[model samples]
Target: MLITLGRRYLRPYAPAIGVLLVLQLLQTLASLYLPSLNADIIDDGVVVGDIGFIWRTGGWMLAVSLGQVACAIGAVVLGARAATSFGRDLRHDLFDAVQTFSAREVGQFGAPSLITRTTNDVQQIQMVLLMGFTIMVMAPIMAVGGVIMALRQDVELSALLLVVVPVLAVVMGLLLWRMLPYFRAMQGRIDAINGVLREQITGLRVVRAFVREQREIERFGEANTALFETSLGAGKLMALAFPAVMLVMNASSVAVLWFGAQQIDRGAMQVGSLTAFLSYLMQILMAVMMSTMMVMMVPRAAVAANRVVAVLDTQSSVVEPTTPVPLASVNDGDGPRGVLRFDDVEFRYPGADEPVLAGVAFEAVPGTVTAVIGSTGAGKTTLLGLVPRLFDATGGTVSVDGVDVRSFAQADLASLMGLVPQKAFLFSGTIASNLRYGRPDATDDELWAALEIAQARDFVEELADGLEAPVTQGGTTFSGGQRQRLAIARAVVRRPRIYLFDDSFSALDYATDARLRAALAPRTADATVLVVAQRVATIRDADQILVLEHGRIVGRGTHAELLASNATYQEIVTSQMSLEEAA
Candidate 1:
């Protein structure tokens, strides 16, 4: 998985990586040449007391040193660019893939995990590339060159490398292997912490109202502690790894010097040769250390890569049409553009015991309001979701204008409807910016008109910035009623063929709800309107009303007809109002 992701995302940066490798090669070669020059300067120039030879040799050494530094700097710069570009492309692809996901897929991984995979996981991969660029490419070159140079000085001294290199590799491999599980655990813990924190922050109001701050705090602490434990476990292994490498490195250096002294004493090697051999040995060990540092990051990065690849690979359950029916010219199919129908529509979440919706059937046509009223968990939201293909019907077809929704391109299907979700959301922006989301090219006058119909213009007009007011993320600055109205205004601005309100008016007071509905009546007169509501009064005057129980339509009639005949309708109505009010 790791190699696959690296290959795929790094494809575009091949040229940059090639240049970086060249730089590292030049730098390592220059670094390897320096010790040989020093040995020559010592053995021939100093031993024979030749100042000119030393000067020329020293000048060459200085030039080589400068070239090495320049190459290293260039290599690091190129590597950074390639790694960051890889991250940018990967993140963009992940976001686009996620955007195509239906609600079912989003729920499958959960939002917190997806967020971590995109940000933290991608960062891990980037870090590995950064370190590998600086170290991994050069390490092998330096180590091999050092061995060859050391053997030129004395083959006997180079023998220490056989023992040292293998030892460091084994120690680092074991330590990293043991630490892999902890890194994996740490990522899971991070997701848990993120989930808990998000839940607490989003539901802070509910938590405080129920006086569960302490309990929430304890929950967060538990998640935090779990993360700490995993991080510490990985940290301990990392801590052990370095000292173990240093031990092998120090032992090898001691063994080289002790053995090289015997060679010098026996007249088999000069002092300059011993000095150069020692330099080469350190270079070889240091190369091993550098490679070890890069390897330390690999296991974590590999795990992260797996997670990211999984997201990219899993296709969305609501697949797009292979040959999409173009909605633009196909709007005249069998009925008016806004007509919607459900035929034995059913939805069951993966692994659930029973379906959320079963054998549900209904139709809404242009120029009329169709209201769905039901108890909590009666699949009101799920039923509305089917029209938008938020979740495709597991058992039947949902059609718009007599064409199956799956047959049309997702974007084309979405263009025919304006959906105001149960939980109204607004991006952080001005009133004008939020309203323009419905139709980006809408005129200011069109925006104000939509706001007026949605009963949101008065409050917006009173604000100091009016249409340019600074809205926070999720429209958190506004009251619930204000947010709902803004969301409705956004939908109104679209003037789409169908308007879907999934209990969007639940936040408004009776007067505001009534006024908003009244104003919207004419504007949406030629469009199909679907309202899913909990309050009995909210849908009482609908042209047609359906009362749902356990995903089935228990009653279908006008308010008076359902009130007089449907037992479930009567129970719901009398629960919310007096018998006289119910009339």
Candidate 2:
């Protein structure tokens, strides 16, 4: 997975990667050449007391050292740039893929896990790329060159490499093999911790209301401890690797010296050659150690890469049209441009046995309010979702302006409809910023007009900064009613032709709700309005009302007509208001 992801994202930076490789090669060659020069300096210069030979050879060594340092610096700089660019591109592609996902796809990969994959998982792969470019690229070159150079110095002493290399390789290999599973577990544990933490933070109010502080604390602690234990297990294996490498390295050095001393007495090898051989051996072992370090990181990075690839590979359930119907063409007719029609719409969640909406049909024409009233699980929100193409219907067609929504360009569909979701979420920004989200160029006059229609102008005016009042994430700084009103204002600012309010007024008091709807009615008089509401009073005066039960419309009429003839509508009306109140 890591290799696959790297190939895809890093391919564009091939030029930079090429430069980095050349630099690494030059640096490794310089490193290998230095030890051979030292041997010559020892045997030819110092041993024979040749002053000019020492100075000349010494100058060459200095020049090689300088070249090595220069190449190393250049390689690191290029490697960093390529690695960082690769990470940036990977993140951008991942985010784009996620953006293409429909609500169903997002749900399949829970929010926390998706967040972890985009962030922490990407970071793991990024770190490996950075280190791999810097270290891994040079390890094999150094190892192979060191072996050839060591043979040049003395072939008999080079025999020590056969035993030393294998011992180090076997020891590090076993330890890394054991650590791989723990590394995989560590990423899973991280996802668990992120999930728990996100849930607690998002539901902090509910937790406080239920007095579950201690219980939540314990839950988070369990996830944290699990991560800690997994990391500790991986850490122990990592710790064991360095010591094992050192043990073999030191033992090999001792063997080389001992055997070389015997060979020296027999005139089979020189002291200078022994020293050069040991240096080459150290270089070889260091190269192996570098490779081993990268190997340790590879397992975790591979796991993370798989996760990132999963997100990138999974196709969004809602596929966009290859050739979208133009917005101008859709709205060209003399008929009401905001007309929304659902023709025999049927929707079932993936893998679900029953449909959420089945054989359902309705229309909200321009200059009219069409309300959907239903029991808690009647799929009111899901129905509204189809209008925005948040999730496409499994069967039938939903059209805006007599054009099937699937045929409309995503941006075109979005531009024509304004949706204020059931949950009024606001990003961390000023009130003005949030309101201007849908229409960035909307003027302050337009903003206030929308705020007035939503009945949010007064509270916003009372704030010290008014429209510039700071909003915390999810609008936690504001009350539910305030958030809902602001969300409504945001939609209003867009001035979209079709407005889908998914029980958007549920958070307000009865008086505020009535006043807001009354204020909203005039502003939206020329546009089509679809309201999904639990409160009968909120939609009592709609041009048409649809009462839903078990994913089918049980009744459709004006509020008075439904109240008089529809038992289901009457049950809902009477539950919320008395007969006198209804009258």
Candidate 1 C-alpha error for residue 425, in Å: 0.8
Q: Once superposed on the true structure, which residue ranges of model 2 sit more than 4 Å away at CA?
A: none
lDDT of 2 at 114: 93
Error in Å for residue 217 of model 1: 1.8
Give per-residue CA lDDT, model 1, range 1-583, as digits (tens). Answer: 8789888888888998999999999999998899889999999999999999999999999999999999989998999999999899999999999999999999889999999999999999989988888888989999889999988999877778888889888888898789878987877898999999999999998999999999999999999999998898989988898789889888887888899889989999988888888889889988988887787788789889999999999899899999998776666555576888989988999898999999888899999999999899999999999888887999998998888989989888888889999999999978899999868999999999999999999999999999999999999899999999999999999989999999999999999999999999999999999999999889998999989899889899999999999999999998899768978
**Each prediction's whole-model lDDT (CA):** 0.91, 0.92
Pairs that clash in candidate 1? none
Backbone collisions counted per model: 0, 0
Best by TM-score: 2
After superposing candidate 1, which stretches have Cα over 4 Å from the reference? Answer: 332-335
Q: Estimate each model's TM-score.
A: 0.97, 0.98
lDDT tens per residue, model 2, 1-583: 8899888988888998999999999999999999889989898988899999999999999999999999999998988888888888989998999998999999999999999998999999999999999789899999999999999988888888999998888888899889889998988999999999999999999999999999999999999999999999988888888888899999999999999899889998877888889999999999998898899999889999999999999999888899999888775757777989999999999789999999998888999999999999999999999998899999999988778999988888999989999999999989999999989999999999999999999999999999999999899999999999999999999999999999999999999998998899888999999999999889999999999999999999998888899999989988888977997
